[model samples]
Target: SKKYHCTYCSKGFSRPSSLRIHTYSHTGERPFECPEEGCNRKFSVQSNMRRHLRVHRGGRPAR
Candidate 1:
């Protein structure tokens, strides 16, 4: 399998797309936002947004 490495954190990914998205964490760029009507929360990763949606679903946010 091919590998992609992060220059800032030394993390490795199997896909270049994953590495590109991970770069947003280093840059502090949040392009994903909660879609709930009253929530203004934003996330640098999609998984975080999915986890955050638990709050809207009446469940605790992931710790």
Candidate 2:
């Protein structure tokens, strides 16, 4: 069972940290940004930003 619930939406999470990250969806806040120069890409979660880093390192996305 989810221990934390989002006040803005129906989504729930097992951890408060996860719930906090999920709230970014409703707030439209992207805290994670690409480190590469000229790349202004942003994401709501760190994991997704980590995945995006692959494109900067490999010049292409994973298939």
Candidate 3:
């Protein structure tokens, strides 16, 4: 059972931090960004951006 519910959609999070990150999916407010020269891509989660950084290191990004 989850305590934190998303007001934007039918989703819930057991942790408040998880709920905060989930809200980005609804708000389109990506706080994490790729700082690789001209790539200039953005993401809502830091882990995704870190994984994306792997591409900069000649590594494939995991889906």
Clashes of each: 0, 0, 0
Could you report the Cα RMSD, in angstroms, for every candidate shown? Answer: 4.0, 3.4, 3.5
Top-down TM-score ranking: 2, 3, 1
Q: Which structure among the candidates has the greatest TM-score?
A: 2
lDDT of 3 by residue, 1-63 (tens): 899999989698899999999999889999988988999999999998989988897786643
Model 3 worst lDDT run, 10 consecutive residues: 54-63
The per-model lDDT (C-alpha) reads 0.88, 0.88, 0.89
TM-score of each: 0.68, 0.77, 0.75
Indicate whether candidate 1 or candidate 3 has the larger TM-score: 3
Q: How far does residue 2 in candidate 2 sit from its true spot (Å)?
A: 2.8
- In terms of lDDT, the poorest run of 10 residues in model 2 is 54-63
For candidate 1, report its TM-score.
0.68
Candidate order, lDDT descending: 3, 2, 1
| Poorest 10 consecutive residues by lDDT, candidate 1 | 54-63
